[model samples]
Target: MFNRRNFCQASVLACGAFAVASSHLANAAAVMAKVGQPLTEVAHLDWLCNAVGLTSTGRLFVGLPRWPGFENTPSIAEVLPNGTLKPFPGGDWNEWEPGKPNAKALVKINTIHIFDDDTLWAIDQGEDAGPHGINPGQKILQFDTRNGKLLRSITLAPAVLPAGANLNDLRLDSGHAYLTDSGLGAIIVVNLATGVSVRRLADHPSTKMSPERRPIGEEGRPLQMPDGSDHQVHSDPIEISPDGKWLYYQPLSGPLWRVPTEALRDTQMSEKALGDTVEFVYDTGPLTGTAIDSAGNLYLAEYDRPRITVLSPDGSLRVVAEDPKLWNPDAMIISNTRELYIPVPQSARMAANRGPGGVDGLVRPFKIYKLQLPALYGNRETVPALVGKPLA
Candidate 1:
C-alpha cells in the first residue's frame, strides 16, 4: 500500500544510482585500458621507411626516402609476407644514382598511397639531390599494383613548383590531386586528367609554420636544426575528409586547419577569398600525420609524444594508443582490415635534430608498427569506402 508518488520517486532514484555506477565502471575501465598493448612490431628494416601504404586488396608498400645519408636505398619497395622488401616495379626503377638519367627512375619518394582501384601512387620530392630545388624529377607516378606497370607520370612544372618546394604529402580524388609544399608553404592542386597544376595558398598563415610553436622530441627536448634554428616544417601533414568535402592540413608545429574542397578547386577564386574560406579545426599540438575514418573522426600522430590520438566527430579527443617505441611516427595509414600502420622513422634522431653534429643519429633497424583498433572505434565497415565513388 505504498503511495504512487513514493514508488515513482524510488524508481527514479534507483535508475540514477545505476547510471552513476555504470559511469564509474566505464571510467575505471578506460583508466585501466592499455590501448597501446595491442600495438605490435609488424615489419623491421635496416633503412628508414617514412610512409606505409596498403592497397584495397591488401598489398602493402613502403616508401624509403633517399635522405642525406641513405641515398642508395630503393625509393619504393613492397613489403613481402616474409617481412622482406622487394624493389617495386623491378628493373632500373630503383637504381637511381646522382647524375644519372632519373627522368624514368624513382628519385626521392617522400610519400606513397594505393587507391582502391589498385593504383599505387608515389610522390618524388626531388630532394635526393640535396634539397637544392625542384627539378624535372619532381613528379607523381602511378603504377598498377597488381602488375607493377607504370601507368602515368605527371611532373610538377617550374611555374607551379618553385625552387625550394618540398612536396610533402598528397591526397587524391576522382578529378584532382592535392599536395602540400612544405618547403615553401603552399597547397598544390593538380588536375588528374589534364596534368595541369596550380599552386594555392602560397605562404598563407594557415600553411605556414607557427613561430611560437616548436616540436618536442622523444628525448623531451626542443628539436633544433644544425644552425640552431627551430626545426620548422610548413604544411606537412595533409588529409581529406571521408566525404571528400574538406581538406584538413597543418604544419609540423600546428593547430590544425581546414578549407572546403570546392574553394581549393575553384580556379576563379581569388587568393583572398580562398584564404577566407579556411576554418580553424583544432589546436592539434605537434602532429606528423593524420587519417580520417568514415565517421569523420581523425586519428592524428602526436609528434611531441609517442602516442596516437583520435578526435571524434563531436570534437572530443582521446588517446587511442601510446607506446615508447613510437619515435617520430611519420605518415600513417589505415588498412582495409581496420589496422593502423605506423612507420617509426625516428626522424627525431636524424641529423637535423642533433645540433651541430651534422651526423645522423638514427638507430638502425627501424621498425614499422601496427595496431588493431578496438570495435569502439570505427571498424572495417566504418572505414571510408572511397574506392568506386568520386572523392568529391
Candidate 2:
C-alpha cells in the first residue's frame, strides 16, 4: 500500500521513541488520554496514515505512496468527522503527474495543504520519480472540493528547475509561498498572484546538511540504513512567517533551517548571497512532520524517538506529548482553537520496500487524542477549529 521509488528519503520521523530537550518536565511523560475512536475509515489504503491535511469544515484529506512492488493503488483518500471514507475522486498518490481530472486520478495526491477557504492545494509530487528521487518534477495543483474538479496546476518553469528538484513541503505568508526541494536541496518561492516561481538556496549547507554530520541517535548511536550504513540528511517541512519575514524549514531527517523569504524571491541576488541569509533555528534530531501554530510554537514529529514535541515562542522547548501510539506522525494541522490534529502517516512498510531494516504496514491504525495543551492532554473545552466538520 506504500510506494517506494527505491528512493531512500532516509525514511524515519516521529515514529519510534520520545526524546525531550528539557529536564524541567518529567522524562517519561504521557499526554495521550486515549479516549477517541479511529478518526475515520480509509479504504484500499494501508498507507493512509502518512501525510494529512484537513479543511475548515473538518473534511480530512490524506496521501498515500506505492507500497511494496505495487504501482497503482488508491493513494489519496478523505474522511469526514463522522468516519466516512472515500478517495478524493481525482487525487492520486502514485503517478508522477496527477491523473487527469476525467479518470481515477483520485489515488495519487500527496503533500496536501488547506487554505483559509479550506480550498485544497495538493502537490502532485510528480507521480513518478526521476534521478535523485525527484517526481513529476515539482508541481502544485489546486482543486475545487465542492466538486473534486481539477481547477489548476502550478508548474515551475524551466527557469526554476535547478537540477534535481522535488517540491516538498511549504507554508504561506500573505499571498506568497515558501517551499523546500528535498531532492537536490533548494528553497523555492511562488507568488500566488503572479504564479511566478523561483528556486533558491540551490545547495545551501543549512538546507542540505549531509545526513552524515547530523547529531547521533538518542543513545548517542547512529541511524541504521538498509546497508547497515547511515545516509546523509537533506531538506523538508517548512513554515513562512505570519508577518512574511522569515521562513522556517528542516530536513525530514535534520535540524530546522530558516531563511529570509524575500531573499529567495529576489531574482537579482545570486544563490551564494541568498545562502548567507539562512539561519539555524532548531536542532531537532529528526522529524517526519513539522507544524507551526498560530502562537508561533513549532511542532516536530520526532522520528528517532516517536513523539510530537514543540519549540515554544521564546525558544524554550519540551516534549509536548509523545507515545508509540502517536506512530509515524507526518504532516499535521492545528485547528483555530489550538487543538492539534495529527495525521500519523505510516512509513515502516515504505522503508522495507527500499530493502531491509524497515517494517511493513497493518494499515497503520490510528486514534486522534483530543486534548488541551501544556503539550499534554487536559480536559479543556475550547471549540476545536475542526469541530464544525462532521466526523460522523
Candidate 3:
C-alpha cells in the first residue's frame, strides 16, 4: 500500500541515521587511540627507581632504592634538564658502605616528596643488607632544594618502628608528617617540630592487607612471596587531601581509606577510637603510589595494569592514561602545572617475582614517564588558593 514517494522518503531517513552512527563510532575510536598517546618519556636510568617528586617550580627528583641488584648506585638523584642523573645533595650523603656508619649516608631510600616550599623529604627504610628490620639508620631527611643543604634529619625510634616495619611513604601537613609501615601494617605519625613519633592504628584491619584482596603483578597473576605464599604488602600508599583535612591511605592491595587529620593528630586517642575513625573511601584495586590534585581527585598507579586511574571526590573512577610501557608504575607525583610523573620500575620483573629469567627478565634503562593531565583537573592558576599553601 506504500507509494513510491513515501518509500523514497523512508530510505533517506534510514541513510541519515546510518551516517550519524558511523560518525559517532569513528569519534569513539579516535578517543580510544588517544588514551595513551600523550604519555612521554621524561627520563631513563640504568638503576631501579621506585618514587618521583616534583617541586612547585617544576624541578624533578627520584628515589633509587637500595634493592638487591642496585646496592652500589646513588640512593637519590636529581634529573637535570639534559636528562643526566646527578647524586642529589651530592658527596657523602650518597655513599653508604656495608661497614660504614649508616647515620651519615642514605641507606635504602624508599620514597621522596618535594613540598611546595621547595623542601625535599626522603625516607630511608634502614635495611642495609639484611631482612627488613628497624635500626638506628631509619630516618626521614629534609633538604633545602635551593642550596642542596641538609635542613633536618629525623630518625625514627625503635620504640615506634617495629622489627618488620618497612616505612613506605610520607605525606606532610603544616605541623606533622604521616608515614606508612608496609611490613607491619601501621601509620607512624611524626611531630615535625619535635621529632616525636607515635604508631597509630597498629595492626588495624584497615591498614592490613585484606584477607580477600590478593595482590596481582603486571603479568596478570597473583604475586607470590619467596616462600610461595601470596605476596602481602600492608599500608603502602598515603596522601593528604588538598585542604589538609583528610588523609587517604591503603595497603598495596587496596580498598582505599581515609581519616580526619584531627583524629590522627590526637596523641591521647585510644587505639580503638582511632581505628573507629578510619573510613572506607573507595575500592581501589592493587595500586602502588598515589597523588592528590587540587580538585581532591586521587591519581593512582594501577599496580596490576598498564594505566593510571583517577578517583574523583564523589567516588567515581576513570582511567586517565594507559600504555603498554607503564609496567608497575610505582610512586607518582602531580606537578603544579598538572603533569603526572610516573616511574615504571618494573618491580614485577625483579628477582622476587620468580619469572622465567629471574633478574635477567628486567628491562634495562628503567623509564620514568610523564603525562599532561586533562584540562578538567585545572592548573595552578585555577587552584591558586591551595597551590603553595601547606597541604594541611
What would the per-residue lDDT of candidate 1 be over residues 273-292, giving only the tens digit for each residue?
88888877777677888887
lDDT of 3 by residue, 254-281 (tens): 8788877888889988877877777777
Reference-based lDDT, each prediction: 0.75, 0.57, 0.75
Q: How much does each candidate deviate from the true structure in C-alpha RMSD?
A: 10.0, 8.7, 11.1
Q: Which segments of candidate 1 are over 4 A away from where they belong?
A: 1-37, 127-132, 358-360, 379-392
Structural similarity to truth (TM-score) of each candidate: 0.86, 0.75, 0.85
User: Which residue ranges in model 3 land beyond 4 Å of their true spot?
Assistant: 1-37, 128-132, 355-359, 378-392
lDDT of 3: 0.75
Task: Assess candidate 1 and give its TM-score to the true structure.
Answer: 0.86
Better model by lDDT, 2 or 3?
Answer: 3
